[model samples]
Target: MVNYRYLGNSGLKITELTYGNWITHASQVENAQATACVRAALDVGITSFDTADVYANTAAEEVLGEALKGERRESLEIFTKVFWPTGPGGANDMGLSRKHIMESIHGSLRRLQTDYVDLYQAHRYDYDTPLEETMSAFADLVHSGKVHYIGVSEWTADQIRAGAALAKELRIPFVSSQPQYSMLWRVIEDEVVPASREVGVSQIVWSPVAQGILTGKYKPGQAPPAGSRATDEKSGAKFIERFMREDILTRVQHLRPIADELGLTMAQLAIAWVLQNSNVAAAIIGASRPEQVRDNAKASGVEIPAELMTRIDEVLGDVVERDPARTVEAGPRSR
Candidate 1:
């Protein structure tokens, strides 16, 4: 069985290693392919799935909901995010406006074929909508049983504080934050992780594989692998140029020996490294096949020794990926 951790301040505990859908959902891949990926994830003890409303133009949820059309729903925690344009019709179509949250939650339920989401999230910060409006709407969802818990994705330190303060006054459950965090992405480590730790919020990390960069599938002086997401037009491969610096590549290259010594894949070692951090409530993984999820699941029980941690820091250096620049100056995480 997968190891579980309580998500932030919420009593709800989920497997520390969870499944997430990005390109895997939506129209980017076939529904049959998506179903296979999810089944593989579940078979390996993944009990949570994180998806966004706008992923694959909202069709991803419909697909997932359909795939979960049996007893499969009983044992799983389904999470879906909002805050993007669902389509081209209304003024209330995007962001965290009260009208959008109110409408979108119902829409998501319809697509998900569920009564309530285990966790409903703000997919990203909404500068246009006031935090009060967003919090009040979320509180209504929690009160009315439309959502079990609440979370925010990709929010900065100030945004989390503002939302948490409002949720506290409203007595609504604000439990977790979803951000791009991984062995290659330490941007959150500098400040965001510390802020979440302080506010008693749990972190459900997305892209735990660093978009497959840290898996050793991509390397310096190597051609992009055939049929890899990095080769796709819509994939987020363009941003990796900054991460592909020679010094960083050298550091990544140094990790191969460690994985080899342990008789594990680089991806497994990369995942094991993240789970060693106590602040991480869960690491959300994306998989296109059963093998990928199975491979990731194996990493759950692999313990990283203190010497390996020291070696990692020394070799990987200070470079880590994030939605923004790794420019934040803050103290290291207190474990």
Candidate 2:
């Protein structure tokens, strides 16, 4: 079983590890395999299910909804996001504008087969839309009972604080932020985490395994294993390429002994390392196979020693990205 943590200051408890279907269910695998993976996650005690309407152009939500059919809805926390263009469209197609946010939530509900979502997230900060308009729209969702809490992903420290301040004024439950956080990606630590803690927002981190780079499967100066994420053109292969450098791969290999010493898989060690931050409410893991879910769930409550943490820093050294200014902004609506 997995441990549950309260999301930020909210009373709602979410599993420490979240099962997210980003590039897996609708992009890389068929519905049958996706269903099996969802079941495997449930069997391993994952209650938080996350997805986005843009994932596979809305097919992912549909598959997840069908797979979760007949389960007690109140027993799980269903999370989804908006801000990405979901289909072929016009000017109002994407971003966190009031019109898009209002329309997208209903479509997401229909696709997910749920009346309400536990936590609805803004997938990215909308530079085109005014923050007040976006926050007010989210406030409307919360007040309407369609959304329990509000969250944002890949938002900067200033963005988080601004949203939290507005949320307080609006009396909306702005509880969480989702950012790509891992041992290899420490950008959140220097800014986002601290700002979030100050504003009562907890992090639900994604890419905690660093796009499977921390698994130690890819060797230095060698080809990535066949069918791995790095070679999967449709599934974040380009994003995974940044960590595939020989120096980075060599440093990753050094983590194996640390994993061995702790009797944990490299993936588990990486996941647990992220959970060591008290401000993190959960670490999100994506999987194309059921066994991957089983392996990652074990990291939920495992605590890593401080000495090993220092060793990880020494090993990873200069390769780690710790820029406080790092923030992934949304692209222009046209793109």
Candidate 3:
């Protein structure tokens, strides 16, 4: 069964495993397939669903809305993000600016077919917008009842600290931090995790399987499988290239014995490793098939022995990317 965790210090409870539609829902798969995957997630007891306004040019949100049309709205936590271009070409089309945020929330609500989103996040820090302006805008959204809690994704420790300070002054709940965290990507542990813990923000991590590399599907010195993400022409292949090296693939092969010993699949071991961190409130998984959701949801309540966890670190040493400075930021839009 999927267990729940308090989002940071907030009373809001979310499933430890969150089903997200990022690059899949409206882009790579059919509506029926996407709906099937969502149904599979729900059937497996996942109550938290995540999406973004910019995914597939805003089609992902609409697809998710249709999938959850008849469910009790209060029984689920629906999270969406703003801060990439989601509208027609214009200076005000993106970022965390009050104008864009205000405009984006309503567009999100309409597309989602919901009266309010449970957790609204800044998809990325808006370097072009002042922190106060962005915080004040989010504060207004919370006060207006359109959004319940606020969070940020892929932000640096410094960025999270600055935002948390303003969120405190505004008396708004900054309850979650979403980062790319996994057994291979330890970037969040050094800085983001510490900062978020200090500021009362739990992590809702993404790419917990390192884009499926940790699944041990891609073998070293072999061409990617026919339908695997590494073979996708659009975006998957590119997004997963960082961990596609032979060194990484070879080291990943060594995990099979550990997984076999624990009676868990490679994917489940990966997700369970991330959940071992107390600060990780949830780990987001994206699936294109209903079976994938069923398989991943089993990772929710798993616990890895400490000795095995340490062995995983030793086996994956050096290949792991732990630099806190690797946190990314987007450049201002060039008009």
> TM-score of the candidate numbered 1?
0.92
TM-scores of all candidate predictions against the true structure: 0.92, 0.98, 0.98
**Which candidate has the highest lDDT of all?**
3
TM for candidate 3 is: 0.98
Q: Over the stretch 174-271, how does candidate 2's per-residue lDDT look in tens digits?
A: 99999998999998888898899999999999999999999999999888899999999876798899898999999999999999999999999999
Mind giving the per-residue lDDT tens digits that candidate 1 earns over 114-211?
A: 99999999888877777899999999999999899999887887778889999999998888988877788876776777888888888888877677
Q: How well does candidate 2 match the true structure in TM-score terms?
A: 0.98
The total of clashing pairs for model 3 equals 0
Looking at candidate 2, what is the lDDT of residue 44?
Answer: 91
How many residue pairs clash (N, CA or C atoms closer than 3 angstroms) in each of the candidate models, in the order given?
A: 3, 0, 0
lDDT of 3 by residue, 1-335 (tens): 78999999999999999999999999999999999999999999999999999999999999999999999999999999999998787989988889999999998999999999999999988878898999999999999999999999988899999999999999999999899998888888988999999999999999999999999999999999998999998979988999999999999999989999889999999999999999999999999999999999889889899999989998998999988877863234331
Kindly report which residue pairs in candidate 3 clash with one another. Answer: none
Off by over 4 Å in 1: 239-241, 321-335
lDDT of 1 at 133: 90
Cα lDDT of candidate 2 equals 0.92
Stretches of candidate 3 above 4 Å error?
A: 329-335
Could you report the Cα RMSD, in angstroms, for every candidate shown? 4.3, 1.3, 1.2
